[model samples]
Target: MTDAVSYPEPLAHPEKRGIELIESSERHGRARDLFPVWAAPNVSVLNFTVGATLILLGMELWQAFLVIIAGSLPWILTGIVATSGPAAGTSGSVITRAIYGIRGNRVVVAFFGWFISAVFLALNWLASSFMGAELLAQIGFTDPVLVPVLVTIIVAAITVLVAVFGHSLILRSYPVVASVLLAIFLLVTAFVLPHVQWGYTAPAPLEGLPLWSAMTIGFAILASSPLSYSNSPDLARYLPTSTKPSHIIAATALGGALPAIFFTSVGALLATGIDSAAMDLGIESALLALLPAWLGPIFVVGVIINTIALNGMTTYTASMAFQSIGVPIRRIPSAVVVGAIGTALTIYLVMSTSLLDAVNLMLQLLVLISGPTMTVFATDVILRRNRYSGDDLFDEQPGSRFWYSGGWHVPGLLAIGLGAAVASLFLTSSVWTGPIAAAMGFLDLSVPVSMVVTAGVYIALTRLAAKRRPTAIPSIEGAPA
Candidate 1:
């Protein structure tokens, strides 16, 4: 396999490579480096918003805490999937070619990978802009119209610049970013804890079926944050193949899950003291109202910085997704394109819709696809025993091992399709409600249901295909015959 062309210092030049394989010569970094890479993004005010939404969804303080912990647990699967990066020395988008075949994988990457990631980029930008605009207003630039537009542009520019700088810069910068955000959030947490009503409950607490339904929806909301990160391999792909898989998994999972749980729990606690009217304005407004005036500007700055860190990874992954989908663009231009699209979406959401409502709907919808997609990825990694050839994965010829059944892997495509279809049946969103969810007293089982169905179907069909035509099975590099 040819080595990826080395570039100059990442800080001085934009990343030139896209989804190309990273050869062993170019691979560097310990598994533990992934901790900050993953953590910096999860240390977000958006996570706090998600936690607050759980309370707004009628979950009690204790129930919201449980949901936060349980929901963030999917970061474990994200960690497992990251193992493929070192094994394959490629982004998650390219690694999936082994599971879905080259052509089939393109379709999956274009829709589930790129489109969803782009939408999230917009959401992150919007969240930061909201906080930023508020900060400007506090400091006397309170033009309702101009402040948002100005903040959105500034935030998008910073985020895209980081993404264009690419992997090395991200690795070098995120630890510092994570440290600053962690300290700020810890301080915020200290102020928040005292205000939490230890025995807080909803105004009119839900009963039996209603309670279960609310909890399920809250779980889906919480789970959506972690599941959106199916691209964990995008960052881990630069780690040496000799890196321990357990270390990779632990670092990535703990890095992401720890902050997510802490920040989200803080949001839930902060919600206990906020009035519904303040919440209606948004989490930023509610949070600022509780914090001392002196800390308000600092919190706002933290939110904006957090958005940049989180969106940097999102944009990087989206650029890789574009390349994985066969876009004839360089990584730098792809980052620009992703940024433009996300900025446009952010402007629209800010001008035309309620941010919280849009966020809730988006998170719920995200679970429908990400759940199954990540499940398939994790399952494939286990079945292959974490062995892959970077060269073979890049091959697109008709006879390449990854080009199954005329460039399609029926088992994988079917697994994801059936899984998403099943998940939709248990979905509860403003967009649509599944009949199964309605029949079961409106319980939303989308997350777990989709994952289980996808894994089961994929295992069954892949085994059947292997038995019928063993040669068609994935080329496991070091497996026992």
Candidate 2:
């Protein structure tokens, strides 16, 4: 009998995996596998809550759906980024060193990677705890204090456990998570769709921002979708080298956008179908009032499961982001650190009087950071035509092409700063309302302003550099020594 070759599980060597380039022999799995595995389960309490706020703010049903579509359109960039994984053979933040140089990438890894992940972990944990507590109460565990504590323990534990195991288990769990959540959401949709006030066109509550501000909020929501692309390569990096770019782009974009739209639309329908007070009670309460009693418990379980799925990914990605920041630790240990920090933040957020206010603030800040970076990175990818030297990517030796001015890509860094400043001028949020936004009647033009300014400056500077030193710009196919 012939001896069989042995292969280890993807997450088997967690410590061995941080930010390193994957060898061709080590890469496996289809690009298409990511569609159901990551996409469907991503629709969680956050998406529903974001959608609910639109209705609560008096956006008409059609308007809400249109905005969701508009916001979701940015998910395409995430899918595009996913295609970079196999060739780059590293996590998203690490891969950006090609554009920004290794030292320069630190700025992005801090803001886009570690910070965004930490904030999201806390946000997801808080939302999950809220839903889990209410679910427990409905099931007769009505001790207010005990329920919240138990929920926190259970949710936090699952997230940490899954993250520590790393990639294989996370991908495997998505199919199950997606199926269960989809079934439950479909049932909720069936219950709510019939009762939706399709013709309701009334203005939102006065406390809500006026029309211009609402539009800004809508764009901010849209920005979050694309911002996710920042770390998408972390998940996509496991695919085989031959995986087609088109396949990765299509799978991720379709997978993520579909469920997001479905759930957000469902929330919109529910928001208009019932009084806003029920929504204020929580997404579960809104569903429980409409869903049959028996279905309510099952749906709540689905909500808990969905929440876990989202947090699990957040914890895993956050760990990768931490590792990308030159942390001298294994992935599992880093994940433990993330879990501890995230848990503490979550506890603080849960005790706060207004979770919605916190969420709005986080989203606003996210747009200001993500919008400029995306413009610069996307432009870099287009300029290079996706051809990159794998060796040069990780090389930080003295003469490495990526070592622009002792590892700092000054132009790229400057563009990010300029973009953030322009974005802040029009930022309208619970965090800090910009003077320009107030003067412009709350126009909220932050995203566009950031994109235009950052792209304009970066492109201009890059072309100028290219003209001055033709040898400085390296093409992906191969570079002259």
Candidate 3:
């Protein structure tokens, strides 16, 4: 009952390959017919889990948390734009298309989005199934390994089901779920905050310059809240007209930023007692340590929702990532693949080992990549242009570009490269924590430093690149399928 979708490839020109240059039609039809009424609920839980979990982990060590916040600020700030905006999109991918331009390459956008989706999907699957298994184990009603594995399987199936049954169900659920998540987080924070030693020097405080171990820890923790930068449009696409665009900042700051302060405060407090294995203990375990065993499990049951809440969004985003590239597996099929691979990795890969090394590599890669991508998106939306009036969002045509230029936007590319390079030097390593390196040599938030480096370098390069010849936005004639 589904039609196979083969995406049209981008042009064969070699220079243009710098961008992915691909467009796709609605290969997979509606995944679900659920109404849009659930948006608030879904967004509520989604933001709470994403925001708190990221801060709880990444900010456990203040300096490390600080480092991550420094580098990731520009992008995370966009959540305000993403959530505060009005409903301008007919489809999620269309937003990406608008920026990519009908004449400009968009496959570049899809490629990065896909990579981000894969990471989110895998992490969320692990977190959710862990929640389900732990809750059951707390009640002594299930076997350990069996329950964990079974729940993972079921979760994966559900993801596939949602993906297959897509549409209003997932989108509408955002606001509703996000509201619940926000409420719970607030309650949890209220309970946990009293325990934190505010301004307490983080254990083994960033030595001299921040330590590599701490920097790495910070880097990993910072990653916990990546969805705001990565998955906003999916949620953004579902924003109601009744909501003013500016309210997004309020929603994001409340739903996203406040949770960070709450989570980090909790993690920091817990670290005071369980400093040695803080990273491994999991935030929920640390809280459980503070309460009675019986209460621990009850609290953990809520924590367990991290995996479910996040993974649901992850699988959903992954399907969109797939569709962006013209992989038209119906909702069910896409969900199945994302869930199976993601959950399987959780049970088999994450359970047996620490993904510390993998996490570092991934964070490093994404930071630089996302920097430019974020710049283009924010720049386009906030500064340069508004809605596309020229071309069908799906059609690849010369609809919008700054100064009406054609071909690749070299300034964006330069900015990303510059940002990543600067960010990397500040990264925790044998030589130094990224910020300390930049700061002891230069002292302040590493993000501001990196932004300066990226912006200056990019501007210089853009001007330089522009001197040779006027380049038009590259023709992604086949961009919108």
Candidate 4:
């Protein structure tokens, strides 16, 4: 018989919330509060560039916007996961053990966690470092290499400090960040829109890539929206348990998708208004040259703020993920460890000549890995109807329901590997494309294909696992008493 869990009121202390199942009483926020957290981070230069790149590659404004809207559709799935947080009362990674077993779940969380945080963190660092170097040059520091190194060190230090303060503070700051960024971008958008040729098309000579290929790139960019689901639970875990799952789902989905659409559409408009060659100089340079003198520096400041905010959240989520890996450290220490390692990587990439190529490679790699992993997790959650024991997530004793197969769920492992393998066969990116993708005229079908394949394989394997071990008690919530 299971002992009843005693959920005291949610603690207000910053240190009290790390890596533990938040008790019922501890949950404090409402569903509507999620909007800023999901919206704020995406209102950045990185997303703008996602739109600009498609136009640079040969897509028309309408085409680019359509592709972006389509790619963002996956966030619907992410919002669904957000709802699981309050009910489960823990980090989503912890709740995953019900599907993959305690030990098996680690593999998924560690890979997805490290990659998602590291890639985005590096991108954020790169953007801020470049701008910082440019600002330094204006003020008389001219060494090409030294300036970037200094900027990276400074930006990474600030980001680490923000992350170390932990969750509640992070939540409080998102709305402020969102408001400032929204105001800045709205002004820029107002200035740029009148100059935009509403019906503009890609120029002849096609910019060296066909329109279809550009659409594929655009799709990959939008897919990053859904891939963000990996960290949404970190925010959602604080909401009141009575917050309806439907409300959680709606808030996260709408909040995230709206900003992404707005910014990306602005990028599409800006892409058509400028000399296409400006695309080669990068989004920041192009925008700086086009905007009036006063507006230019303000744009840079906005990007810097966005960079720090995005990286700060990445660092925080990564620390929680580390703790979920069974590490004995507290949340702040884990944040420090991941922050240092991520900072080192950011500095290296910022200082390197191959920075753009490296960033593209990292994004493609995420597209490859995230699809199957997300599919398996989503399938598990849906099949179980999101029911989870708040107590079981942390229990590791021998008889714990989550300890299946000595902590490894073979079927789950097999499904993920097989699904990712099949998806890689059709992936297209700057770094690599699968043979099948190349054969199919280099169309990127990685995300959809991986989801379908993983879903099918996981469903079949899970059913088989059940039949093969008829007497084995299932670990899912609401299993037979």
lDDT per residue (tens digit) for residues 1-481 in model 3: 1233232212221110101212233222221211222222232222322233333333444553465354334434555346322334433444554444332334564566656666656555555555556567666856756776777677667655545544344444444555555565556556666665566554333443335444544543354343225455554443444444455544543444444544543444544444446546444344545554555554444544444555666666566555554554444455567676677666774456333333434444455455555555554444322333212444443433332246345555555556666666655432345665555532223334444565565445544544443232212121111
Best candidate (score: TM-score): 1
Question: TM-score for every candidate vs. truth?
Answer: 0.96, 0.90, 0.66, 0.91
Model 4, 138-162: lDDT tens digits are 6699887788778777877877777
Query: Arrange candidates by TM-score, highest first: which order?
Result: 1, 4, 2, 3
lDDT of each: 0.85, 0.72, 0.46, 0.74
Candidate 3 wrong stretches, greater than 4 Å? 1-76, 80-93, 97-106, 130-148, 160-167, 171-176, 179-208, 211-228, 238-244, 275-284, 328-332, 355-365, 390-392, 397-418, 429-481
* Winner by lDDT between candidate 3 and candidate 2: 2
Instruction: Indicate whether candidate 1 or candidate 2 has the larger TM-score.
Output: 1
lDDT of 4: 0.74
Residue pairs with clashing backbones, model 4: 9-25, 10-25, 10-26
Q: Looking at model 2, report the run of 10 residues with the lowest lDDT sum.
A: 1-10
The whole-model C-alpha lDDT of candidate 1 against the native structure comes to 0.85
Instruction: Please report the TM-score between candidate 4 and the true structure.
Output: 0.91
Regions more than 4 Å wrong, model 1: 1-3, 7-10, 469-481
Tally clashing residue pairs in candidate 1. 0
Clashes of each: 0, 3, 53, 3
Q: lDDT score of model 2?
A: 0.72
